[model samples]
Target: MKQISFKNKFGYMMGDVANGLTFGMSAGFLLAFYTDALGITAAAAGTLFLIARLWDAINDPMMGVLTDKMFRKRALKHKNQKVDKFKIYLLKGSWPVIVAAILMFFAPDGLNGTQKLIWAYATYIVWGMTYTFVNIPYGSLAAVMTQDPVERSSLAVARGIGGLIGNILPRLIVPLVLVQFTDELSKGYLIAMILFGVIGLVSYIISYYTVEENIVHQVSDVESTDKDGFVKSIGVLVKNRPFVAVSIASIAMLLGMMVNSAMAVYYFKDNLNALQLMSITGLTGLLPMLILAPIMSKVVKKFGVKRTVATSSLISSIIYGALFLLPSNAILYISVSFMAAIFMTIPHMLVWGMVSDCIDYNQYLCGKRQEGVIYGCYSFVRKMGQAFAGFFAGVGLSLIGYVPNAIQTSQVLWGIKFLTIGLPAFGMFIAFIAYQFIWNLTPEKQKEVVKSINM
Candidate 1:
């Protein structure tokens, strides 16, 4: 076994931070932009978002297959030095993520309503599909980079720290940074999106150069997966009990996150009577992950990943439920908001690392390296959950008599309140249940799986 240097780990963490910044912006504010800034009705915007992302459920596995083939073909052509091929693929893959980030924010020249939705469909599909191309390979790079569990855990923490930076950038800074650009909301968001794309591109470039793959320690199983065989891989991966459980848990966790993301935007705008509170709430939501990340590994080690995630999620659910049950005061809101933030973030940081472990488990089970496909499966489900959240939020808003171009009624305000706080609270509760019962992988078991694979 070889060890990864601190320098390499730091570089990868910075890359993760940049990725977090870009993707975080989408989760943080994409729905707000669609409904309010871009002049699409909330329901229509929600449908479009769902449809566009559903396209990714189809596209992600293909990207995974393509990634596997790229590795296979490179192994053949390079023969002796196959590691360079994987590195080259990863370096080149970064650009698609950068481009997609820019395109998702683009509102074409002279488009309204139906036209805008069509434009959104086209660009958003490309963005989601291309992002998969980048992220699948990027996710797989970790297992290839180092075999040391301690090193991998450190990398996960650094990635969390980076994500905190990324989440903060668009949430906290964009509103302030884009103020000087234009009064038109769409234009401001467009500018912010472009700026984020550029920043992502620069940071991804640094990551490509600074982080090195631990090619020498890599286990070779040069079997190529068929791009047309997603259905088969789905069956195979689902049969792996741990992967199935983790996927379900991820869907529940992400549903909570995405739903709250949309609802929080609405809450701050309407009930709170503080439209700009998004920036403050967003900053507060982000800090816990940053502050707690350094110790997250130790915490998980002590408590174990499943228990830590389950507990945090349960706490978050209670806090979300209490947000409505408690008095609606400034101090109460602030306190619950911070607690909700911590709960939302801690589980997220740990779960992805856990998901990565599941990929390794699948490899051990099948005697094939299918990290890309497995990660794609996880991403596919999570994105589908996000789509569902968007749909639910839209439907909930419409049912609540959310009217466009008019003053909202007390009933509508009440609807908005439930959609934001109540819905996510339920999701968190469901997630807690899933984690407690479904996820059965303990740390010692995971170590055994890894050991069995290497042997």
Candidate 2:
């Protein structure tokens, strides 16, 4: 077995750090930015998210094909040296990603509503495409890093830590900063996003330089034309029962997660009448992840990824459901939210490891490994869920007539409560159902798949 050093794992983790910085910012605040700061209606902001993501439905898979082709060409040219196909994209793609992230937030206040919407659409689509350029390749890199299941879990843990920092910091700090500058929320967002963009660029550069791709399996090595290879790759992924099952479950889970994150600001401000409590909520959520990081490998080894995810999903559903009945005090709300966060972190930490497992399973079933394509397809579905979540949250808010920075009416308050709590609880139940009924990859089966691939 090929050994992945600590340095390699740390570098791989940093890629996700960069990813989380951009992704976390968008997932947590983009809609709020549009509605509150940019003077767009909630429905319009949601439309922007949906339209950009619709384009990703095409752009993601094509990037996967392009990534695989690049890997094959690099291997042919530099036969003597190990060429890192994914990292090359990370290095080159980071520039546009950084620029686009800043542009997405830096819309000119001088533009009319229509002009601003156009700017939002153009910059956001560019952000999504460039993001795919970096993210799909980065997500695909783990399958080629090392084949050890336990090691993959450990890598996921490291990535989880990076993800937590990248995700939580912006959520916690940015909102707090914005509250201080309520008179100039837009300016505050611009400064914060630019700062995050710079940090993301630096992190990507470090990750590109630090991580080495040690394991290589060329998907394009088969004796077939490019078109034939691409079609076959898609067929393999489509026919993969485990991949399909996991994808369904992932979409549900991500939809809930994104909706919760996006609605949190509104929930805290409008319902709880405490905007600063978001920092506390973010901190409490971070605690469980910190406690679990050191021992997640052991947990996965004992419970298995699917079981862990299923169990966690069910627990989260229960907690969210319980929140509806609990006293509406900040203390109780924070406590229940903390408990739900604990359960939610398990799946978040294990998801990438499970993706690596699916890649291996695909290779086991088919004689070729199309990591880029497989990861791309998976990402495509995940992005779809994210788009719908944003749309739902935006539309849901609009339906209840949520007014930005105003004292919300009772009906709007109830709607915000339902969005923050009820919708995610339902999403969690759907995820649990998908995993219970659809996923069939057991621990023993995963071992067999890995062993067969190694042989």
Candidate 3:
């Protein structure tokens, strides 16, 4: 077996960091940008999200088919070849996704109504499609790199460390820039988003060049059995127990995080009257990710993935719930919440790699390798979860007597409090339940599965 090096691991980690930059910023800021910055009503934003996501579900499977076909064609052309097919296709085709990511964040001025919605729909949907294009293959690259469980665990830690920097640093600093750059929040957010979009494009390109795929699994070159094979792919994935569990868990986690992101912005600006504290509080939340991520391999080895996630989720839930009952001092809230975030960051840093582990387990059980379908389904669930966050947050704000661009009311402040604190705590509880009871893949079982897959 070839030894895993810092160069190879860091290269793969770069792609993950780029992934975090694109998706994390989108999730963190898009709804706020739409409502507060782009002059869209919260209800309309929710409706837009519901409609666009309903339409966008088609993109995920289409991407899976597209990636699979590309892989198949590469194999055919390079038949009996020593070179890895996925790596070549990745190097050649990753640019479209990067371009699409940049375009998605480019919201020009001097547009109204239909034009604005059109821009949002076209850019956002295309970005989602492009994200699927890169992610399916990028995720598959993990298993391709190495079969050793220890090394894969190490890789997971390294990738998380890189991701912590990519994800946490921007979010922590962007708010400070926005607070300083423009008197209007929207204009500030717009500039910050564009900057992030450009950064995302650059990082994605760098990652594409730096990373290489090392292993290729051989599928039987039989005649195509069904023209409608994508449906079959979905069916195969549904039957995968580990896939289903991890998918549910990921959905819950993403939904909670998105709601928190939107609410955190609201809470800082509206409730606390400490908008600039957003930058400080964001830094506090991110601290654990930066410091603890490199050591995640040892943590997971000692505690195991399930215990690690479950413990973190539970601790976060309790703290989030208690935040509702605590005194609303900015310093006090920030202090306690940061400690909670330290524990909470573990799952954020490490869970996708756990999903990768689940994919390996599924392959071991089913006697088939379907990373594209499994990962595609996983992304579909995550996007759906994001959609729910947008929808719920809009409705939650509406119920809380929140009227945009209006003066403060005690009731409206209460509503913001509920959404920011109560909703996410509930979501964390749901995640805890899913992972603690639903996920049965322990480290020992994962080792057994890896052994079987290699055998």
Measured by TM-score, the strongest candidate is: 2
Off by over 4 Å in 3: 83-109, 181-187, 219-228
Which sections of candidate 1 miss by over 4 Å? Answer: 84-90, 177-183, 215-220, 224-231, 329-331, 404-406
Error of 2 at 141 (Å): 1.1
lDDT of prediction 1: 0.71
Point out the worst 10-residue segment of candidate 3 by lDDT.
219-228
Highest lDDT: give the candidate number: 2
lDDT of 1 by residue, 1-455 (tens): 65777777777766776677667778767777776666777788778767877888777766667777766676766666635424454467677877777777766677767888787677777877766776766766676776555566766776666767776778776656445553576777778877777777777777778777764423246553544366777777876766776677667767766777667656666676655556776568667976887788788778887888788889988898888777545456767878887886776776657666777777777766576777777777777887788777776777787865367888898887777777778877787887788777787987888888788
Better of 2 and 3 by lDDT: 2
How does each model score on TM-score?
0.91, 0.96, 0.90
Clash number by candidate, in order:
2, 0, 0
lDDT of candidate 3 at residue 453, scale 0 to 100? 81
What order do candidates take by lDDT, descending?
Answer: 2, 1, 3
Pairs with steric clashes in candidate 1: 17-162, 21-166
Cα lDDT tens digits, model 3, 336-360, are 7787677677776666676677678
Q: Give the TM-score of candidate 1.
A: 0.91
Q: Candidate 1 — number of clashing residue pairs?
A: 2
Q: Model 2 over residues 1-455: C-alpha lDDT tens digits? A: 67888888888888888888888888888888899888899999888888788887678888888887777776777776656768888798888998888888885858899998998898889999999999999988888788888889988887887888788878888878898889888788888888888888899998888887767655345223244567778788877877887788788888888888999888888788788888887688679888998889998889887888898889999999999766556777888888888888888787788888888888788766677888888888888888888888888889999888789899898888888888778888888887777777898998899889878
